[model samples]
Each structure stands twice: as C-alpha cells, then as structure tokens.
Target: MTSTFHVRGGRPLKGEITVRGAKNLVSKAMVAALLGEEPSLLRSVPDIRDVAIVTELLKVHGVKVDRDVATGLIRMDPSNVERAHAAEIDAHAGSSRIPILFCGPLLHRLGEAIIPDLGGCRIGDRPINYHLDVLREFGAHVDKRELGIHITAPNGLKGTKIHLEYPSVGATEQVLLTAVRAEGVTELTNAAVEPEIEDLIAVLQKMGALITLQTDRTITIEGVERLGGYEHVAIPDRIEAASWACAALVTKGDVFVQGAQQKPMSTFLNVFRRIGGGLDITDDGIRFFHPGEPLRSIAMETDVHPGFMTDWQQPLVVALTQAEGISIVHETVYENRLGFTSALNDMGARIQVYRECLGGSSCRFGWRNFNHSAVISGPKALHGADITVPDLRGGFSYLIAALGAEGISSIHGIDLIDRGYESFREKLTALGAEYWED
Candidate 1:
C-alpha cells in the first residue's frame, strides 16, 4: 500500500521530540554482526524500512537475527551460517549500499560472495568504482556478472594500502569492513571521517579488532585472526536532527529535539547559528527556535564528515527560501542533489541552478550539466502545492516546505520518508502539525 501525506500549512510547531538511532550507523552495525563468531547485540535500533530490509538480507544469508521491537535491541548470530541462496539474496540486490559491506565478511567466512547491483539515494552517478578498486587492491578477484558482482579470494584476502581519490562514505566503509579481517595491516588514507564511520570503528574495537584512528584523515587497521561478539548503542541520527532543526526555521516555530547530541553536530549547529537560528543544548538533546529576528542567508558547501552533510542540504535549502537575502549552496557530494529544488521553485521560490562552480569548489557535477550549485533568492511567500518526493532527504525537505507554506499541500511518495523517519506522522502531530494519510 502507498501512503501520501495531506498537510495543512502555516502552523508554528511546538513541543519536544526525540530522535532515534542513526540510520547510517545502525545498518552498518547489523552488517558488522556477520563478521562475528557469536551473537552480537545492537541497541538503540530504529524501526524503519531500510533496517528491516537489511535484517531480512542477513536472515537469507543464514544469520539468525532476533529483533526486540519493544526494547529496540537486535541480536544477530552467524555461528551456523554457511551459504546464501542466490535467488533470495538477489531479491534485495540494488536495495542499498549496505549489502555491499557483506562482501568482505561473506568472503572471509565462505571464501566467495555474489553481490547484486547496489541501490540507494539517486542524487548522482554514485559509482562503485572506488569500492571495486579498494577490494581488488586487497587481493579479491572481482568479476562483473550478469546479475551482480562476483568475488573470490581463493588465495585468501590480504591487507594492502588504499588511497581513495574522493573521500566517499560508502567506499571508506567498504575498505574498513573488508580490511579488518584481512591477513595483514591495512592503511587507508583520504577516507571519509563521518561520525557514523567513527561509530562503526567503536563497534569494531569493542569486538576486539585492532584499529587505530591516526588523525581525522587516515585509519590503520591490524587484521585480527578472529572477532568476538559485541554489544553497542548506536549514535543518534544527526541528519534527522538537522532536518527537524530546519523545520523550526521554516515554520518560525520552537522545537526541542531530544537525544540529539551536540558533539557530533557542532558544525551544523554553527551554520544554524550563523543563519540566526537559536539553539540551547541540554543534558541529552538540543532545542532549536527563532525568537527575535528572521532567518539570514548564508553560503554553504557540502563535503565529507565534519563539514556540511549532503543529506542535510535539501532541507536547509528549503528553509533558506524564508531567509532575508540571497543564499548560495554548493553541493560537493552528489551531482543530482539540487534537482529536488525545482519542486520548491514550483511553490514560488526564486532558485537558480548553474553548471559551473559558483562557490569556489570544483565538484564532480560542476561541468556535466548536473547543476552542482544553487542560488536562492528569498523571503518570498510560499503557497502549498502538490509535490512528489524524489528521495529520502528530498522528501523531508518537502515536508518542511509544506509546513511553512499557505493553504494545503499533498505530498506523494511519503513511504520513502518512512525508510529513515520513525513514527514521523505521530511525532508531527505531537508538534502541532496537521498531517494525515489518505
């Protein structure tokens, strides 16, 4: 069944909301359980579609995944795992980038793996060239099959140095997971230093893996002979936190986001403050509101971790439409990220896309008609309209845009929003948002 959200706009949202575990970290943590010799326990897991898909994928691979919905805890036991059925495995091929992380653990346990085509956010040509290059560097024989990637480490996997041309999150994670079980030491330079990556490392360390973080740019791993099961609490969702923060700005409301840690969200908080958004950090969360002045325009550039996240860019761009002056956004992560801005433009926004690098960064999308840069001229009154959500973050941006617009908005493809958001309908209702499913 498909669900769409019918939202009545122009409401000032109030009240407190708690964020769930990090979607990015929880999925990777589930995959890490496959590498363990015993059952691993993961806490703070969110009830979402992508996590459910990953759990099913692990079950098909002969891993026993026991999920406790009430407690948000999951136990995965791969002790008796042997082989994965291709038909069952292929059903979820191209579902997410996460399934690819299983390649290393599968090869480590069964000596071979057949991975189906990968799928995730379609913001650009997110090619797996970097993944294949890093895996082959570690002595894995990779062959492209009709259905997916066929890999074998007949001579056994060995550790090697990998240098990524771009600090891609997926590629960096693939290297870390695959290299942790290799025969020797693996050195990775120019890796993505996202907080989720750090969380994964912490989980690996708890499982008795010999890993060290040398500076923010490099990681050194000494492959161990065996890994033990571990128990860990996943980090809070920073992307979700930032999205709700933008919701406060767009609606000119006050919202308190519980469980949103400030340590990992410092960069985003700084940007929000620069745009005239107010923040107050408490023991367990952060509260966002606009008290006196309207939002101000600021320049933004998306990059790897510790920089502006690409996932948060869409929602923030929507909020920028209510700002005073012109706002510039340069997307350095994905080429097609700015395409969703057209939907906002349909609702009376002055946003222009350009093919050249407008904000002093040479992005991959700059020369290819990808329109890597966006210039938003705003303080315009937005009217609600029917809009279609293109992807996860884009869908959330539409929700924020709708909350600040006049009249009614009918948003389609709302199920995509559920892939990451948990009980979003109930939460919005609690915060004074009039949303219903039709």
Candidate 2:
C-alpha cells in the first residue's frame, strides 16, 4: 500500500538529529563483500530501503547476512555464495540499479552473471552502457535475452585500461570490483573521486586488494589471486546531513546534525554560507541554523565531487525559494533534476526551468532539448499543495517545502524518501515538525 504524509506548516523545526552511513557507499560495500573469501563485517549500516534491497540481493546469492539492528552492524558471510537464478535476482532487486555492480563480483565467482533490467531515479538518463563496455573490455561476453542481459567470462577475467568520458561513478565501481580479482593491473583515468569511492577503496584494501589513487582523477588496482574478509566503518551520510541543513534553512529553524563531517560537505557548507545560512563546523558534527537575517540568493552549479553535488541541489533549492532575489541553479549533473521544482512553483514559489544553461558555462545538456537549468525568483511566500515524491532527493525536497509552507500539504509517494533518509519521520517528530500519517 502507498503511504501519504499530511504536514502542517509554518512552524520552525528545532532540536538535534543523527545521520547514519553514506547510502552511496554502504550498498557498494555490500556488493564488495561478495568478492571476499570470508565473512565481512560492516559497521554503521543504516536501516534504509537500499540497504535492505542489497541485503536481500546478497542473500539470494547465498551470502549469509547477519544483522545487529541495535548497533547498526552487519556481518556478511560469502562462504556459501552460489549462482542465483535470474528471476530470483530480479524479484529482490526491484527498481534498483545495484544489480549492475554485481556483474563484476558474480562473474568472477560463478563465471556468469545475470542482471535484469536496471532501474533508478528518473533525474537523468543513467544508461548502463559504460558498465557493459567495461565488462566487455575485461573479456566478458554479453548475451541479450528476453528477461535481462546474461554476461559470462569464457577465459578467466583479465584487467584492462579504462578511461571514462564523464567520470561516471557506476562505471568506476564496475572497474574496481572486477579488477580486484582479475589477472593483471587495471588503470582507470578520469575516474570519480567522491568520498564514498575512497571509503570503498579502504574496504577493498582491508580485504587484501592493492589500490591507489593518483593526484589526478586516476585509480589503479593491482589484481590479487585471493581476497579475504574486511572489517570497515562506512562514512557518514553527507547528503543526508546537507538535506537537514537545508531543511533548517527553509524552515528558519535550528538543527544539530550529530554525525555530519566538515570535509565531505565543504563545498556545500560554502554555498550554504553564501546563501546566508548559519553554520558551525565542529569535530563531531555540524550545527545549521537560520541567522535571523534576510537570506540571499546566489548563482550555483552542480558538478562532480569538489563541486556542489547534484543530490544536494534539490533540498538546497527548497531553501532558495525563501531567498530574497533571483537564484540561478545550473544542474550540470542531471538532465531532469529541476522537474521537481514544479511542485514548489505550485506552492507559490517562482521557479522557471530552462533548456539553456543560464548561470554557468554551457554543459553537455546545454544545447540539448533537456531543461537542465533553473532560475528561481523567490522570497515568495509558499503555501501548501498536494504533491508527489518523485525520487529520493526530490522526495526529501518536497518534505522540506511542505514543512515550510503556510498550510497543510498532502504528500503522496512518501515511501520514496526512505530509500536514503534513515527514520526521517521519527527525526522530524523529534525536531517538533508537525506531521501526521494519512
């Protein structure tokens, strides 16, 4: 059954909330467990839909997934891992793109990997061609079937050099997972160097893999004959921390995010300060609040790591609705990210989507027909409206708009938010944001 949230607006949210492990890192780490010859212990695992999906996917492949929910620990034993049926894998991995990451590990272990049609957020065209091409580079033969693609390595897998055109995260992950067990060293240039990728590298190292990061965006993995278990602590959820920070700004509230780190969120923190949001960076966590001053609007662009993240742009856009002047957000990451702004516009915010890159250098989608940029004319008082949660980040942005509106908002498809945010409703209640289930 679908769930809905009835949010009563105009009250500022206050108090503290804790964020868990990075959603981006945790799932890939779980997939990395399958490469180990022994059980891997992962700490700080979040209780989210994606984690659950990954857990189920691992269990289907005969990995023993033992959980300690109280302490957020998961012990994944891959000793009994075996080939899983195509239908079974499809059933557990519904609407998740994680199955593609399984291709590398599964092909190494079982000599074959079957992946059903992949699904993820509709923010852009995240095709798996990069993944398929990477697999082909490693001598995997792809056979298309009615259900999904079946991939197999006739000869044992061998490492090869790969250079991504756009530094796609998934392609980089595919190379890392596959190259760790291949026959020779793999060199990858123009790779994604996000913090989550670094954490994954740490996990691989603990499992006896030789990997190195260059000063440039290049990664090298020396293939090993065997990999053992890993004991690792996943990184904090910077996206979730930034999302709460934006929530505090939009509602003119004060929030103490208990586990936020300053390093990963440095770019976001800079943008938050430029937008006139109050922030205090500390050793433990970051405190975000409204400074009781007029919020300023600024031109922003979303790029890869070290730039403003595309995931952070959605929730931050909700706060931009309350800014005093025109704010231009050029989304260089996703083509359809600004579509969720339509709901905010319905709530009395003045946000216009444009096909041309308005505030920054022309990006890949600038000359294309895709409307990838947004111009928000704000300080407009927002009212309540019925809305639908589109994707994970977009869903959270809707909740932010609803909480800051002047009237009650009826939100459908609220379950989408659970894919990333951990116990957000409980945290919202603790922060004194008035919301009820409908």
Q: Which lDDT tens digits does candidate 1 get at residues 1-438?
A: 556888998998899898878999999999988888988999989888888888988988888999987678999999976777656777864457767788888889889887787778788887777778878888999999887788899988899988888888888889888888999999999988899999999999998898888785889999988998999999999999999999998898999999999999998999999999999999879999977698899988988878888888998999899999999999988888899989899988889998888776687766677788999998888899999999999999999999989989999989989889977887898899998787
Task: Give one digit per residue, the lDDT tens place, for model 2 in 36-82.
Answer: 99999999999999999999999999999998876889999999889
The most accurate candidate by lDDT is 2
Please report, in order, the local distance difference test score of every candidate based on alpha carbons: 0.88, 0.93
- In candidate 1, the residue pairs with backbone N, CA or C atoms under 3 Å apart (3 or more residues apart, or in different chains) clash, namely none
TM-score of 1: 0.97
User: Candidate 2's error at 401, in angstroms?
Assistant: 0.3
Deviation in angstroms for 210 in model 2?
Answer: 0.8
Which regions of candidate 2 deviate over 4 angstroms? none
Error of 1 at 144 (Å): 2.2
